[model samples]
Target: MFRLNRLTDYAVVVMARMANDGCKVRTAPQIAEDTGVPLPTVAKVLNALARDGLIVSQRGASGGYRLGAPPERITVAAIIQALEGPIALTACVDGQSGHCESESLCPMRGNWDRVNNAIRGALEGVTLEDMTAGLFVPMGERRSPAALQQASGK
Candidate 1:
């Protein structure tokens, strides 16, 4: 059940679209049209991205939003964290106490830590430029050997 929320997915789509446009200043409507995202949602995502310093917003006529830094400098992890919070599979993995009273005695605590780190590292390996270049893989689209096992029916 691990998955990105709708807003985070939309944010990545918006950013990837912007990067595909050579990282130019794009109006919300333009991005909405290009990415098939709703106008209001695009506005909300843009505002969040700007507030996170991931993008810069311009006002007045002929103004729009553009990347605050080069696309190459922004990682997928940054985008997801901006839209969501820190990437942690479980609260305990992120230094937060779990609802389970026996969290202190959980046998899989270290395993969850390693799992969290592995997932974070995979996301950090992808940049906005990779997204723009169509080299980025969505969570469901990842095709590692372990993932392929499901299809192989092994």
Candidate 2:
């Protein structure tokens, strides 16, 4: 099964919390408390995110971390890439040096790239804003078809 590692999952949770909080800088402890992730894990995830330019960190008594760019500009793919590197499902699709030893003999070589790109594109289409907003509307609040059409500018 294709699955995100625990840390990647935590990173998304952290980011979603941050996005919901707006541009305010948050300490790792604060993020951990809000997200129910462990303090150490949140710190580790924040460090990786900062290093990868997903979040900016400031030092000293009052300093904390904030999203490096607007939430809408940050894609799920970027967050995954920051914590887990490229989103390829297999070594053959990674396009890195010495990724696959059977490249010369494998008949499926290069074919995985198309699938990989498709997955990446899907991830890229989703922004942190969309993620934080979630996939389902509230139970009592359903948009009328006209409202949905208007929202989509159709």
- All predictions: root-mean-square deviation over Cα? 7.6, 4.1
Tens digit per residue, CA lDDT, model 1, 9-89: 999899988876765789999999988999999999998899899999899897999988888899999999999988988
In candidate 2 the C-alpha lDDT for residue 130 amounts to 76
User: How does each model score on TM-score?
Assistant: 0.79, 0.83
Model 2: per-residue lDDT, tens digit, 1-154?
Answer: 9999999999999998988888898999999998899999999999999998999998888889999999899999999999999899888875554677887888888889899999999999999987776323455888787776666566
Worst window of 10 by summed lDDT in candidate 1: 130-139
lDDT of 2: 0.88
Cand. 1 TM to true fold: 0.79
Candidate 1 stretches greater than 4 Å from native = 134-154
lDDT over C-alpha atoms for residue 150 of model 1: 57
Give every collision pair in model 2. none
